[model samples]
Target: MAFGIAGTVAGSADAAEPRLMAALGNTVLTMTDIGPKHTQVSVNDKPVFEDKESDMLSFVGAYSLKDRWIALFQADTGAKDCPTRFRILEVGGPQPLVSYPFGSCSDAAQVTIDNDVLTISMPQPGGGGEAAWTYRNGKIGRTK
Candidate 1:
């Protein structure tokens, strides 16, 4: 596995855009380009998640909840039903906590943290309504 450091990737072009980063205590979380069209998430310079699909992945933000770090990412696939989706992941963890369709590719959403609650506000494509989620007991679930 090839690893890139900071602003440049090994044998890859200099990143055209800025990389997304967040600080969790002493650990650093980064979403950087592994190649021209690939993106990977690394914690303290170690690769945690790498998107191999053609869909473009963009880091939305990272937040701290109850002393745990979580990161959100947006994936754009250009599909008809759900062209765009959001991925929730625990920082330094290997898997996503949640992956849900937000809406079209151009749709916008906001993620906010209050105390220990994680709230996501966005337009529902099919007409369900707004959505909210919370992380408790080390698991992520929709607020009922």
Candidate 2:
């Protein structure tokens, strides 16, 4: 497998454009959602992810970066736009995957994919930082 760092991000997050569309080879995954609050994500036509009862706002975002299917699950931490947790998923995946380590909820953050690396950053949160993850050998490893 050829490894290269991807430098592009493709997705839509506008309030008016509350839909997600991504393609992995020929299998296209389309997500429709009501977001930034109680987001319910439906993939390909059926519901696959939802978070309720936590009183924490949840959101779902999808992207096609480096030919990989990436989905982001974000939960707010009571701050206006600050998120407490970000769960990144490589959809339509090769299983037995690596589990990401998320520290205690500290700040608001967003998710990004770069060169096969998935990063969740909470720059807006005062003491909260960020982490980067890479998928290789069927394992998810933190690179930074």
Assess the local accuracy of residue 66 in candidate 2 as a C-alpha lDDT between 0 and 100.
66
What TM-score would candidate 1 get against the native?
Answer: 0.66
- The estimated TM-scores of all candidates read 0.66, 0.47
Candidate 2 per-residue lDDT, tens place, 21-136, comes to: 66545554444435444444444444555555234533455566665566555556555443366555565654312135342454444566667666555443454455445543
Query: Which pairs of residues collide in model 2?
Result: 5-115, 6-115, 82-108, 83-108
Model 2 worst lDDT window (10 residues): 1-10
lDDT tens digits, residue span 1-144, model 1: 344256665777554342777787667777776665577877776676767653688877778776567777788775776777666666534433444434223357777777777776675566667655555444656663
Q: Give candidate 2 misplaced runs (Cα > 4 Å).
A: 1-39, 56-60, 77-83, 94-104, 110-112, 123-144
The deviation in Å at residue 76 for candidate 1 is 1.3
Top of the candidates by lDDT = 1
